[model samples]
Structures are given as C-alpha cells and as structure tokens.
Target: MDPSQFSSQPPEAYKSSGKSGMPAAPPPAYQHNPAGYPPSFLNQPVPQGPYTQGPYPGQPAVTVQPAVFVTAAPLANPVPDYLAYSIFTMLCCCLPLGIAALIYSIFTRDANNSGQRELAEKNSKTARTLNHVALGIGLVVIVVIIISQIVIRTAR
Candidate 1:
C-alpha cells in the first residue's frame, strides 16, 4: 500500500458513525408556575369528622394498656444428680442397685430440666442412697472373698 493512501484524519465512515457534530438545542425553559396543570391532591384540604378522634359516639372509650411480660426466676441452689457416682457403682460395685441408681440419677436430671424442683430433689436423694448401698455391698463382697482366699491358702 502507498503511504499517501492513509490520511492523518479518520476515514469518512468513522467520522459519520456517531452523533451529528451540531450542538444540542437548549432544554425548554423551566416554567416556575404550574399554571396549565390540574389541581394536585396536596393543595386540597384534609376532611374532618367525628371518626377521626376516638370511638363512635355512645360507645365506651377504648383504653390501650402496655403489655406485661413475666419470666420465672432461676433456682438458687440446684440439686445434685449424682450421675458419675451412679455410673461407677453400676460398673464396678453392684449391678442391680447400680442400675437403679443410674436410672434415678437420670430422672433427677430430667426433673431439674423440666422445672420440677421437688421431684428433682427426691430423685437425687434416691440415686445417692442407691449408690451408697451398692458400693457398700461391693466392698463387703470383696472383703469376704479375700478372707476366704487367705483361709484356703493357710489350710493348704
């Protein structure tokens, strides 16, 4: 291609592609007075009647009372469930009593959670008693077995 074919200015197709080179006409002057326009709702006066104030005539006056909310207070000293003691007795001490203790312990926890303070205390006491009995029985059995083994060895 000859260097003379490419002019410094853009091609005719590019120059005519966009908006016309003429400046836009100035926007119509804003009419401050809305003279020819219809009346707006803002210009109209608000309606007044008996319905605006309170209850209709002859009916009792309605009083609005503030809402009241009541929540229960948390217990100061919660009862002990004795769950660990019950489990230990069940596993190592006596099976039947230990199982009973575990059940009572679970009952105690459930009662406490359900907001039954009296029931929780009762179940807690029962579990503790059962654990004590189970542990006592286990200790007595162990002692008796050891004594018997000692006697057998001496006899031999």
Candidate 2:
C-alpha cells in the first residue's frame, strides 16, 4: 500500500519531476571560482575608490653597504751615508781608519737602497765611529810632528 515501495524511481527523482504541480526554487548562483574571490574581482571591472596600503610595496626596499678597509703607515727609518766625512779622514787624517770608514759608508748606502734597514743603520754607525777614530789618530800624529820640528829648530 506504500507508493514508494511500488514505484521503481528513487524518492528524490519523484520529488523533482514536477508531479506535485509546484515549481522548484531557482538553482543556487553558479560560483566559477571556489576560492572565495568576489564576483566583481573575477569579472572584468576597474576597481573604484581609494584602497588601503598593501602588506608591502614592490617587494620592500633592499639596502646594501660596501665594505671598508684601513691600514696603518710604515715606520720612518732614515739611514745616512758618511762618504764626505770618510773622504776628509782619508785625505787629512789616518789612512787605515779612513779606509774602513769609507767601506762602511758604501755599505750603508747599498743596504738602505736594498731595503735592509737594520743593516744600513749599523753600517752608518760604524762609519761614523771610524771617522772619529781617524780624526783622533791624525791629531796625535800632527802634534808629535810639530814637537819634533820645534826640538830640531831649537838644537840648530
């Protein structure tokens, strides 16, 4: 005696087949994008009114600074050549000490030019010492010669 038990069609089909003589409500609006974007954004329409600032503008500004390097100046080292003094010692003073002074003077200049600062300084000091020794020996020899000359003149 049940109508659905006797019918072959499903209950849902019978409900929508218009057999009851009443129209069904229109189907819900078709949503093209299921992501939830508004219909106006999906359709072609220029946006109206001022908009709020975005999370970031143009991927945010990037600032990069260059590296700087600093270095201190080298120490000041001056080495002098005693060639003039050596020459004066050789010509007017002791011959042996003057020769040693001259050799040291040449060594000082060569070492300085070759970037051997310590060696150049040592050689310059040696040259000055030799010059002083030569001057002292020369003064003693001069005094002795003068005394001998005075004694000879007094005897004559």
On residues 1-156, what C-alpha lDDT tens digit does candidate 1 reach at each position? 898879865666656544778654555655343443332344543335423445443689989999998654444676899999999999998999999999999999888776778998999999999999999999999899999999999999
Error of 1 at 136 (Å): 0.8
Best by TM-score: 1
Instruction: Give the worst 10-residue stretch by lDDT in candidate 2.
Output: 48-57
Report the alpha-carbon TM-score of model 2 versus the true structure.
Answer: 0.50
For residues 1-156, write the lDDT of model 2, one tens digit per residue.
Answer: 876586744557645565766775555665564343334443444334445232232477666699987643332565887999999999999998999999999998888777778888899999999999999999999999999999999999
User: Which stretches in model 1 have alpha-carbon errors above 4 Å?
Assistant: 1-76
The pairs that clash in candidate 2 are none
Q: In candidate 2, residue 77 scores what lDDT? A: 66
Task: After superposing candidate 2 on the true structure, give the runs of residues whose Cα lies further than 4 Å from its correct spot.
Answer: 1-77
